[model samples]
Target: MLAGLQNVTFEFGARTIVEDATWHIHPNERIGLIGYNGTGKSTLLKLFAGEYAPSAGTVERSRSTSIGYLHQDLLSFDTNESILQVALHAFDKAKKIERELEEITKKLEEHTTDELLHAYSEKLHEYEEAGGYTIEHRTEEVLQGLGFSNSDLKRPYREFSGGWRMRVLLAKMILQQPDLLLLDEPTNHLDLPSIEWLEKYLQHYKGAVIIVSHDKYFLNRMVKKIVELYQRELHIYNGNYDFYEVEKQQRVELQQRAFENQQDYIRQQERFVERFKAKASKAAQAQSIQKRLDKLDRIEDVTIERPNIKINFNVDKTPGRVLVELKHVSKHFKNIDILEDASAEIDRGDKIALIGANGKGKSTLLRILAGAEPFEGERKWGHNVDDAFYAQHQLEALNINNTILDEMKEAGSKKTELELRTLLGCFLFSGDDADKKIKVLSGGEKARVALAKTMISKANFLLLDEPTNHLDIHSNELLIDALNRYQGSLILVSHDRYFISKTANKIWEIVDKKIKVFKGTYEEWVEWKERAESRNQTLASGSAPVKEVIKETPKASSNGQPTTSTGGANAPINKEAQKELQKQQKMFQQLEKQLADLNKQKAELEAELSNPSTYADPEAFKKTENAYRQVKDKLASVNADYEKVFEKIMTLEEQQS
Candidate 1:
C-alpha cells in the first residue's frame, strides 16, 4: 500500500467534517471520491497530500514514496515561460542529480583519497537509480499525450486559458509519475474525444490514482473503488461508481429495517413498564427494566435528505398547436454568420439537446430560441406559449439587496410562504439561508437560486443552458430526472454526456457551421459514429488487393470485371463486421430502455387497480387490465429479443477475435 488513512477524524469549528474515516490507496488502484458539496472531499484530499494537519489520528505513508496532486483551480505561473518549459520542471530534480553525477565523475578522474572515491561511487548509484538519462523523453511523451500539440508546446503559458493551464499542470503531474496521484474534477473542461483518450491513458497508467469528479460516466469507466463522504462520516466501497450506488442503496435499506426493529423493541418495553409500574410487588422489576432500557445501545434513525430542486412541471392547459417554429432563421453577430438558414421546430413535449464544441454558438442559438436576443430570422411562436429561460449567467439579473425568498416571491408564482420555503429548501437552502442577501451567495448558489425562480414561472417551454454546471453528480441526476418527467418542451445546451444520454430524446449537433438533427439516444449516436468511421477507413484503404485478385481470376466478364465470387473474396470488407456490431449494440440499448419504461407503466397500472374507485367503472377496469397484460407480454418479448441479439453479438465478437 502506498498510503492509508486509519480512524481519521477532522473537524471545522464545531462541525465534524469527517469522523473515523478509514481507507486505503494501493498501487494500480483507481479510486473515485464523491460526496455532496461542502462534504470535505477537497479537505480530505488536502489531508492525504499532507497539506493539512489532521486534528486526530495519523495518515500513514510509505517511506520515501512520492505523490502528485492536481488542484481544481490553476494558480498563477511564470508568464515568460512557455508551456514546454513549465512541463520540463517536473524533471528538474533528475537533472540536478545528473549534474551532481557529472561533478562526481570529474572528482573521480583526479587522484583522490579512498573516502572521495567512495562518495563518487555513491553519487553514481543514486543517479542511475533516478533514471536521469530518459527523463526528458518521458516528459515530452506525457505532454504530447495530454493534447499538447507540437505548436502549442512553444506558446507562452500566459496566453492559454485557465482550462488549458490546468492541462499543462496535469501533464507535469503525469511526467512526475509519483506513486500516488490526486486529481479533483479532472474532466471538467475536457471534450468527449479528449475524455476518451484520457481514459485509455489512465487504463495503462502505473501507480495509484484518486479522482474526484461529478461525471458519473467517467467515474464508472475509470474507478475501481469509491469513497463517499456524507453526514460527517466517510463510507468506502470496493468497486466502481455503479457498484457503490447499489451497495449504498442496500445499506440504506438495511438501516431502515434495523431502525424499525428497534422501534418495535422500544414500544414493547414501554408497554411492560406501564402495565407493571403500579404493582408494589412488581415495582422492582419495572425499575430494573427501565434501567436496562437506558443502558441499551440505541439505533439512530436514518434520515434521507430531499433532492435538490425537484421540479414537477406539467402543461395543464395546452398552448396553440404550433408551439415554436423557425423559418429560415439566419443569426449573425459582428458580421459573422454563426447560424444561417437554420430552422427547427419545438413542439409540445420535445426534449431536445443541442451539442457542439466550444465556440460553436450553442448558447447563441439557445438565446435566440428563448427570445432573449433578436436575430435576422422569421421566428414564430404558438399562441399562449409560456417560455422560461435558465442560463448559466442568468444569476446576474437578480437584485443584490433581495433575499432568496424575496426573489421567489417577486417571481409572481402566487405560492405561500411555506411553499416558497420548501422550494428553497429543495435547492439546499434552509432556515436563515433563505433570508440571506443574494449578494452574499456564491456563484453556484446564485445560479441555483435563479433556477428555482425560473421554475416558479410554471412555463410550458423550458430553455436550459448548461443547467448541470456547479452541481454535484447526485444533484445533476435530480435535475435530469426532473427534466425527463417534465411534460413540456425542453431545449438544453450541455457538454455533460451522461445528462444528454439520459434526458435527450433528440439531438441537434452543430457541425461545420451548420446544425444537423438526429433522432435517437446518445448511445445510438455513438454506434452511428463508429460505423461511419469504419466505413471511411475501409474506403481509404483502396482496392489494391481486389485488383490483384481480378488479374488472377480464371473467369472474367466482357468488361474485364472479375467474377462476383472472386471480388467478394478480395474486398477489404471489415466495415460490414463493424456495422453488425453497431446494430447489436443499438438493439440491446433500445431493449433496455423499453423494458424500464414498461416496468414503470406496469407499476402505475397495478397501483390504479388497487384503488377501489377504479372498479366502479367496469369498462375502464377491463381496459386497464388488458393494457397491463399487453405491457407484460411486450416486456417478455423484449427480453427474449434482447437475449437473442446479445448472444449473436457476443458470438460475432468471438469470431472476429
Candidate 2:
C-alpha cells in the first residue's frame, strides 16, 4: 500500500466529517472517491495528502512512496516564471543531478584522477536514469497535452487565468510521476479533448491514482475501485462507477435483509425473556436468554437516506413549430471572432446539444438565444416562446444576504410558501436548511438552488449551460431523467457525454467558427465523425470516390404523362444502382447477424467462466477460459468490421436518397 488511514476520524468544530474510517491505497490501483457535497470527499483527499491530521488514529504513508496532489484550487507559483519553468519544478531532483554531473565532468577534465572519474561516471548514470536531458521535451509534451499552446508555455504564470493555472499544476503533477497521485476534480475545468487526453494519461499511469470527480463517464473509464464516503463512513466497491452502482445496491439490500432478520430474532427473544422472567420457576432460563440477547452482535441499518430534489420544468405553454432560429449570427470578443455566420434552427420539441472546445462560443450562442447577450445578426424566437436559461455562473446571481426560501420566492413569486418550501426540500434544503443564508451554502448547494429557480420559471424553452457542473452522479442522473421527460424544448451546452447522449436528439457542433447541425444522438454523431474522418483520410491518400450510376428511364412530361425513355431525362436511380443497393443492404444484414451471433456466443462463454462449477474443475475452467478469450477477440474484430460495413451502407443509402 502506498498510503492508508487507520481508524481515522476528522471533525470540523462539532460536526464530524469522517468517523473511524479505514482505507488502503494500493499500488497501481485506480480509485474513485465519491460522495455528495459536504460528505468529506475533499477532506478524505486532504487526509491522504498529509494536508490534514486526523483527530484520532493515524494516517500512514510508506517511506518510499511520494505523493503528488492536484487540489481543486490552483497552487501558488512564482509570478515571474513561465509555465514551462513552473512545470519543470517537478524534475527538481533530476535537475540537481544534472548540476552535480556538470561539476563532476569539469573536475574530471582538470584532474583525470581515478576517484574523480568514478564519481563522474556514477553521476552521469544517475542523470541519464533521471531523464535529465529530455526533461524539456517531456514537459512540453505534457503542457501541450493539457491544452497549452506554445505561446502559453512562454507566458508568465501570472498572465494565465485561474483555469489555465490549474492545468499547469495538473501538468506538473503528472510530470512528477509520484508513487501516488491525488486528484480532486481534475476534469472540472477541462474541455472534451483535454479530458480525453487526461483519461489516456491516467490509463497508462504506473502509480496509484485516487480521483474525486463528479463526471460519471470519467469515473467509469478511469477507476477500478470506488471509495464512497456516506453516513460518515467509508464504503469500498471493487469496481468502476457503473459496477459500484450495481454492487452498492446489492450490498445495501443484503444489509437491510440481515438487519431486519436480526431485529425479528431479537424481538422474539425479548418477548420470551420478558414472560419467563416474570415466573420464578423459569428465572434461570430467562437469565440465559437475556445473556444470549446481550451477547448478540446487533446490526445497525446502513441504509443512507439521500435528500430528494424534485426538479420539474414547468412549461407554461407549448411553443410554435420553430422555437428558435439563428440566422447568420456572428459573435466576437475583443476583436476576435468566436463565431462567424453561425446558423441553426430549433423546433419546439427539439433537444439540441451545443458542443465545442472551450471558448468556442457555445455558451455565447445560448446567451444570445436567451436574450442575455447581443449578437451581430438575427436571433429570433418563434411565437409564444418563453425561454428560461441556466448558466454555469447563475449561482453567482443568487442573493447571498437572503435565505434560500427568500431567493426562491423572489424568482417564483407565484409559488406559495408551502409549495416553495416543498420545492426547496427537493433540492436538499429542508426544515431550517431552507432558511439558511445563501452565502453559507456550498457551491453544489448554490447550484441546486439556482436549478430550483430555473425549474419554477414555467418557460416553454430551456437554455442550459453546463447545468451539471457541480452535480454529483446521482444528481446528474436525476437531472438527465428530468430533462428527458421535459416537454419544453431544450438547448444545452455541456461537455457531459453521458448526459448529452441520454437527453439530446440533435447535436449542434460549433467548429471552425460555424455551427454544424447533425440530426442524431451524441453517440451517433461521434460515430459519424469517425467515419467522416476515415473517409477524409482515404480521400487524402488519393482513393477514388464511389461512383454513382444513372440510367435512362421514362419520366413525366409537362402534361404529367410518361414520356418515352429515348427522349426523356434519366431517373434518379437505375436498375443497376438498385441491384447494388440491395446487395449492400444484404451485406449489412449479414454482418449484423454475424455480430449478434458472436456476441451471444461470447456471453455464453462469459457465463460459463463465471459459474462456480466451471471453476471447481481447474482443467475445464482453463479450457473454457481460453475459449472465452478467443471468442472475445473474435467478437471485437467482428464488431469493428460491423461498424465499417454499417458506415458504408449508410453512405450508400445517403447517396441513393
Candidate 3:
C-alpha cells in the first residue's frame, strides 16, 4: 500500500466529513474519489495526504512512500526562470552532481591531481546513473505533451496564466514519478487534446493515482475503482464509474428492503409491549421484550440526495431553417492562422459541439459566431433569430453588492421568485442560500450565479462556452438534462466528452483553417473517425474525398456507397491490427487517386495528339508524343504499386480473421 486511512474519523468543526472510514490504496490503483458538491471529497484527500489529522483512529503510510500532489493551490508557485528550468528541478540529485562536476572540471583545467580526477570520475558516474543527460529532453517532452510549445518552454514561467502554470506543475510532477499521484480536478485546466494526452500517459504510469473530478467520461475511462464519500462514510466500489452506478443502485435497493423488513419487526414488538404492559401475568414478559427491543440494532432508512432543477428554456420565436450562415470567414492572431475562407451553416435545431485542441480557435470561433469578435467574414443571421452568448464576461459583470436573488430577478427571465429559487437549488444555492450577497460567495458560487443568469435568458439560439466548468457531477447532469430539453438551437464548447455526447446532435471540428461538419452525434463522430483512420483517410482531407462517407446516423449501421476508401468498417477488428490495415489501405487509396490523375493526363495527351494544330508544328507533335509515353510509364508503375497494396490488404484481413 502507498498510503491509506485506517478507521479514521475526520471532522471540520461541527460537520463530520468521514466517520471511522477505512480504505486501502494498493499499488497501481486507479481510483476516482467522487461525491456531490460540499460533501467533503477534498477534505478526504487532505486526510489521506496527511495535511489533516483524523479526529480518531489513524492515517497509514509506508515509510518510504513518496507522494506527488497536484491541486489548484500549486498556482501560487512563482518563478522567473524558463519553464524548462523549472521542470528540470525534478532531477534534484542529478542537478547537484552536475554542479559539482562543473566545479571539478574548472579546477582540473587549472591544475590536475589524482584525488580530483577520482572525485570527478565518481561524480560523473553518479550524474549518469541519475539520468542527468536526458533530463532536459524528458522535461521538454512532458511539457510539450501537456500542450506547451517549443518556444513557450524558453519563456519565463511567471509570464504564463494560471491555467498554463498548472500545466507546467503537472508536467513537473509527472517527471518526478512519485509512488502515488493525487490529482484534484486535473482535467479542469486541460483542453481536449491535453486531457487525451494525459489519459494516454497515465494509462502506462507505474505509480498509483487518485483523481477527484466531476468529469464522468474521464472517470469511466481512467478509473478502475470508485471511493464515494456520503453521509460521513466511505463506500468502495471495485469497478469503473459505470459499474459503480449499477452496483450502487443494486446496493440501495437491497438496503431499502432490509430497512423495510426491520421496520416490520419493530412494529410487531411495540404492539406486543403496548397490549400486555397492563396485564399482571404478562407485565414482566413485556418489560423483558421491551428491553430487548431497545437494545436491538436498527437500520436507518436510505435517502439519496441528488440535485434536481427544472431548466425550462422558453424560445420566444422559432427561427428559419438556416439559423446562421458564415461565408469566406478569415481569422488570425499575428502569424497564426485560425480560419481562412471557412464557411459553415448553423441550421435551426442543430445542436453543435465545436471541439478541438487548445489554440485551435474554439473560444475564438464562439466569439466570431456571437459577433463579439471582429473577423474578415460575413455572418448572416436567419429570420426571427434571437441569440445570446454566455462566456466569462457574464461573471465579470456580476454585481458583488447585490444578493443572488436580486441578480436572478434582474436577469429579466420574467419568472417568479419561486421559479428562480428552484433553479438556484440546482446550482447548489438552496433555501436561504439565495439571500446571500454575491460578495460573500466563493468564486465557484459566483460562477454558478452567472450560469443561472445565462440560463434564464430568452434567446432562441444560445452559444455557451465551457458551461460545465465549475459544475459538480450532479449539477453537470442537471445541466445536461436541461440542455437536452431546451427547444432552442445551441452551440456549446465543452471539454466534458459526456456532456457533448449527451447534448450535441451534430459535431463541428475546425481542421486546417476550415470547418468540417459531421451530421451525427459525438459517439457517431468518434465511430466515423475511427473507421476513417482505419482506412487511412483523414476526416479533414486536403482535397475531395473518394466519396462522402457520412450518413444521417452512424449508430444504426448505415453504409454510404460502400466503395473502397469511403465505407465504414462494420466488422470489429483489433485496434492495433486495424492500424496496420489502415496504412496499407491508405497507400492503395493514394495509388488509386494517382491512377485517376494519370488516366486524366493520358486522356488529355490523346486529345492533344488528335488536334490538327499539333501536326502543324513538328516540334510540338514530338513533345506531345514524349509526354504521352511518360504518362503511360508512370501509370504502369502506380498500377503495380496499387496491385501490391491491394494484395497486402487482403492478406492482412485474412490474417486478422
lDDT of 2 by residue, 1-657 (tens): 889999999999999998998998889999999988668898888888888899998999998999998986555554789999999999999999888966875664455565765665566567667876468878988998888877689989988877788998999999999999999989887888788899999999999999999888899999999999888889999999999999988988999999999999999989999888989999899999999998999999975566555566667787789988888988889956888887778887899998877767788888888888877999887999988889857678999999998998898548888889877765667678998999998877888888878878888788888888777776777788788888898899887888888999888877657776777788877876675566534432223333321212123323221111122333355456556656655676677788788878877875664454553444574588688778767866876777676666555543442
Q: Which stretches of candidate 2 lie over 4 Å from their true place?
A: 75-78, 99-121, 307-309, 394-396, 416-419, 425-431, 439-445, 537-657
Rank list by lDDT? 3, 2, 1
Which digits, one per residue and each the tens of the lDDT, describe model 1 over residues 1-657?
Answer: 899888899888898888887887889999999998778899988988999877888898988778888996456654779988898888787678778756854664554456655665565456545655456556666666666666788899989887678888988887778899899888776656567767888888898899999888889999999988888787889999999999999999999899999989989998999999999999899999999999989888888655445756645456776688877777778855688777767767678888866556888888888888888778898888889899966778999999889999998888889889987776667788999999999988999888888777778888988777677886777778777788777889876889989998777776545566666677776765575455333322332232332233322223222112223324353567756766766676778788889989977886665554554454575688689779878876887787787677654443332
lDDT (10s digit) by residue, model 3, range 1-657:
888899998888998888999999989999999988889988877877788899999899998998898988889889899999889888988899989977986876677666776776577568767877568768887998999987899999999999999999999898898899999999998998899899999999999999999998899989999999988889999999999989998999999999999999999989999999999999999999999998999888989686455688877898899999999999989969999998889998999999988889999999999988999979998999998787875676889999999999998889999999999988888789999999998877898898888888888899999989888888888898988899989999999999999999888888768887777788887887666555433322223232222322133223321111222334444567556766776677788889999989888886775554554444575688689889978976897788688777665553342
lDDT of 2: 0.79
Whole-model alpha-carbon lDDT for candidate 1: 0.76
Q: Estimate each model's TM-score.
A: 0.72, 0.79, 0.81
Off by over 4 Å in 3: 105-121, 536-657
Clashing pairs in 1: none
On a 0 to 1 TM-score scale, where does candidate 1 land against the true structure?
Answer: 0.72
Top-TM-score candidate index: 3
Error of 1 at 162 (Å): 2.6
Would you list the rank order by TM-score, best first?
A: 3, 2, 1
Candidate 1 displacement at residue 469 in angstroms: 1.5
Q: List candidate 1 stretches off by more than 4 Å.
A: 76-78, 94-151, 277-288, 307-309, 314-345, 371-385, 542-657
